[model samples]
Target: MITKYKLYFLTLVVSLLLLGCASKQNFIDKSKSITKETYTYHTFENKNKLQLDFYQSINYKNTKPLILYVHGGGFSGGARDENYIKNYCSKMAKNGFAVASISYRLTMKKLGFGCNTEASLKKEAFIKASEDISYATKYLIDNKKKFNIDTTKIILVGSSAGAEAILNLAYVYENKILAKEFKYAGVIAMAGAITSIEKISTKRAIPTLLFHGTKDKLVPYNVAPHHYCKKNKKGYLQLYGSKAIANKLKELNTSYNLYTIQNGNHSWNSKPMFVYFREMISFIDHQVLQSKYQQKEVVKKISDYTSTDL
Candidate 1:
């Protein structure tokens, strides 16, 4: 009887060991699917705090890079993880990047752009929107240790109005404007425009990759006074068309790249969208931040002045 009892105990111990091994293997398998995480963040509406849902990619391996996304709704309305960005975000996250889709305050016309003449008030709200994005990113960074992530290597992605916020976040940090806490390696902007083109044309931060369409009727292909803001003449926004803007960047000698989708709509998500993002992820994996190239023509004013002195 004593011998039989000992054997039973030994068999139980072996079974427990096998279960432990299975758990370890399961962990290894999950590490490969970090992009499947989705989460929500909190902010305020009229001084009252509220929760805003965002889809966050799970970091199974704890090593997947991160990309923070801000969805566009003309600066007024849009969910953080719209279906448009959902699949793409998942594809990116699953491939090895933790992605977050964020929500921000909308404009008065965004079911609420009131008739208040206080443009500053409206702009302030926009500023708040940017703040929310910054905070969300910072939250991720602060918890990097818990997540086993490289907090320093982060990519910011946005579309349309959200792109505006991301660009502003990049360029305005020096001005102490938005997202002062996070680090960004690069940017992927789709149909984005800066609030102040003069500011953007004169200075920039990280390398920005842009994708825009010629017939885009929303953000316009150019700056104000010519933005496609008005369908009648395709108004002034045409100045932002990738080619025109690329020329400007060329003149500025900023290290940037562009892919102008022929007659591409405001945000084209069809052609191998996943594939395009994957390629960019690889690019970000290897690129280092550096001084942007200034085009002789764009910076010719400064160069000309220096040359005259010479």
Candidate 2:
């Protein structure tokens, strides 16, 4: 015969297990309203391959705008199809947009991005990743007709290291890789920063949406060293995070939106991807597609998640 105490303990264990499952579900949207296809974008000298996973609405139509997403992994490790990213991409596809998650060279995989790593090597990783982004864009543009993509409306989206690469491509780096006239429609950076705010002149600025945590230590919320490496360290490269980038855009009279998560941390990199999906779509539609010029700043406490997030 089972004792009353044993029965109560078993019931409690079951309850906790159910709650755990529910919390996991909250992180990703599981709707199946999208279609996905994978394509090889590049082949390296060693015969290794880089690919992109494209997502679109199941009720597909032509000339849809694309959200070219780059995954965050601190330049060392990350994949194009992380679950959270797929969830976000699926949600966007359902809302009448196409999404592409691409694979790029992880140059910093061997040497971690820390105080011990050389700053120049870190910068090279950025350049190499951005170059891959450019090549991915070229592949999509070349196959625009087949993919039914509006090449002109391709917005760049990234998380963490991915964010840094896209930001660098948008502001600091010249397009010596792609067509001279080619330009990204907009930029959505999640916990991203740039090397130089000076490159964000009137001629180079674009519609940008930035999401960052005020207390982010890995990627500064304002101007600070990358990973907060000490000045005496070789990897002490200063970065201009979301706040600084938005300020630069403001100075240039450019369209930009800055979402500051108070007391949040590096985790904000992926959280905003799902939590602020509506806001992201709004920015893309109004700021990028419609070419509306609007500058706005929003701040919310981390505790706000209890009332707002899924």
TM-score of each: 0.65, 0.89
Residue-wise lDDT of candidate 2 within 1-310, one digit each (tens)? 9653345334434533443443334523444556889999988899988899998865556467889999999899999887777777776675666789999999999999998999999999989999999989999999998888889899999999999999999998877779999889999999999888887888888999999999998999999999899999999999999999999898888899999999989988888877886688778767987789999999999877875473
Model 1: per-residue lDDT, tens digit, 1-310?
5453244334434533543443222433443444344444554556744233333344244454567877777666777655556665655554445666766656544333333224354455556666777777766776777555566667788777776677666654343422445457778777765545445554464566666655666555455422323434321222233355556666676666676655656654233244255346434543422233422211112122232222
Query: Quick one: best TM-score, which candidate?
Result: 2
TM-score (C-alpha) between model 2 and the true structure: 0.89
Candidate 2: what lDDT? 0.85
